[model samples]
Target: MKVEGGCHCGLVRFEAEVADGPVEVLACGCSICAMTGFQHVIVPQSAFRIVEGRRETTTYRFGSGSARHIFCTQCGVKSFLTPRGRPDAMSLNLRCLDEGHGLDVTNVAVDQV
Candidate 1:
């Protein structure tokens, strides 16, 4: 299934090709994810693309500085980013996906790291 999403202010937009069935997502309890309420849908880098606003985004890194927390410069919404644990993948914020994408999301495991 193909999912399209964007930041709150519509500054940054993206598209991702995900599996066409029930999907598992992670609810991370790390400081940044917890404070921002970010639910993670991890996808391979080849399955994701920035459809627009690539230049309108900014990145922030902390801790080991491996994960790149990308946000819309205008709205400060981290719709997607590169995860430290999976450099070959991108973590899309499940909450940011546009409605009617037909994603049966389940198995929401919470992790504190």
Candidate 2:
């Protein structure tokens, strides 16, 4: 399925392709993930494309500095990130989508902390 999403202020928009079946998401217990309520829908980089406001996004990294946490500079909404577990993939924030788009989400709890 093709999904569309963006940051809160509409400063960052993107499109991604997910599997046609159920979309499995990850709910991490790490500090950032917990604080931001990030539900990760991991998809390959090739499956995600930035449609607008690429320069309006800010990239943040911490600790291991492997994952590239990208957020909107205007609204501070983290729409997606480069995940450490899947270096070549992007972890899209399920909440950032249009009302979550009614995806069949299965949240897998991860003790990343």
Candidate 3:
């Protein structure tokens, strides 16, 4: 399935191909993710693409500095990340997606919850 999303201000847009059912959505308890209420699913970098607004995005790293948190500079929304694990994957925020994407969000496990 192809999923689309962006920041609250619409300054950052992206599209990704993901498995259609029984997806793994994580509820990260790390400092930044905890503070931001960021729940997500990790996907391979090749499965995801920035459709627009690259100029409006910025990266933030901390601690071990492996995770690349990409946020919209315009709205300060942390929309996605180059996950520390498995290096080739990205963690995209589900809440940022366009509506009617047919995601069964409520059925997934919340890792840190």
Candidate 4:
């Protein structure tokens, strides 16, 4: 299904068409991921698009300087980012998606770093 989402201020909007299923998602064992607690089906660069809010978005890189933490400058809501552990993949913050279809995230397991 096509999922549309953005930050709290709508300053970092995006649209992505993803498959409907329990995809292979990982709860990272990294310092940032451990604190933020993100989860989702990882997608390659080809799967995501910044439909709007490019100017309102800002990036923060740390650690190995591989991950690009993209978020809205207005609300500071991190809707998505490129994964450092898997440079080729983008990590979608499931908490940010507007899943009006009643998405279920209960069974998604989360392990600490």
Candidate 5:
């Protein structure tokens, strides 16, 4: 399914293609993810595209520094990231997606910490 999303301040926008069926929502117990309330909806990087506000995006990394966490500099919203384990994948934040995407959200625990 095709989906659209962006930052709170409208400084960023993106489009992505998710699985055809139910979207898998992974909830991580990591400190940063938990504190920020980030819900992971993983999709391959080839299926994701940034449509606007590219310049307003910033990258953050820590620990292994494998994943590149991309956030909106203006609104401080972490909309997506290049996942550590799957460098070829982009993990989108379900909370940032526009409504009516027909995603059947499921909570799956991840030991990211």
Candidate 6:
């Protein structure tokens, strides 16, 4: 299934190809993710694309500086990021996805580390 999403201010937009069936989201207990209320839908780098506003986005890195947290400069919303654990994959914020994407979130596993 192809899903489209963007930041709250609509500056950064993206598209990703996800599994067609039920999807499993991750709710991380890490300080940043917890504070931002980010729900993750991990996808391979090949399956994701930045459709717009690439120049309008900013990157932030911390704690080992492996993960590249990409956010919209205008809204400060982290729509997607390159996770430290999966450097080759993209971790998209489920809450940022546009409605009617038809994603069935079957499970939300809490990951605290």
Query: What's model 3's lDDT at 89?
Result: 88
> Local distance difference test, per candidate?
0.91, 0.89, 0.83, 0.73, 0.89, 0.91
Residue 24 lDDT (model 1):
84
Predicted structure 3: lDDT: 0.83
lDDT of 6 by residue, 1-113 (tens): 99999999998999999988889888888789999888899999999999999999999999888889998999999999998888889998999999998998964657632
How would you encode candidate 3's per-residue C-alpha lDDT over 1-113 as one tens digit per residue? 99999899997899999887767778877778878878877788999999999988899988888888898998899888887665798888988878988876643544342
What are the per-residue Cα lDDT tens digits for candidate 2 across 31-60? 899998999998999999999999998999
Alpha-carbon deviation at 23 in model 1, angstroms:
0.4
Q: What's the residue-level lDDT of 44 in candidate 2?
A: 91
Superposed on all Cα atoms, the candidates' RMSDs to the truth, in angstroms, are: 1.2, 1.4, 2.1, 2.6, 1.2, 1.3
> How many clashing pairs in candidate 1?
0
Q: TM-score for every candidate vs. truth?
A: 0.95, 0.94, 0.90, 0.81, 0.95, 0.95
* Candidate 4 residue-wise lDDT at 37: 67
lDDT of 3 at 52: 93
Q: What TM-score does prediction 4 earn?
A: 0.81
Worst 10 residues of 5 by lDDT: 104-113
TM-score, cand. 1:
0.95
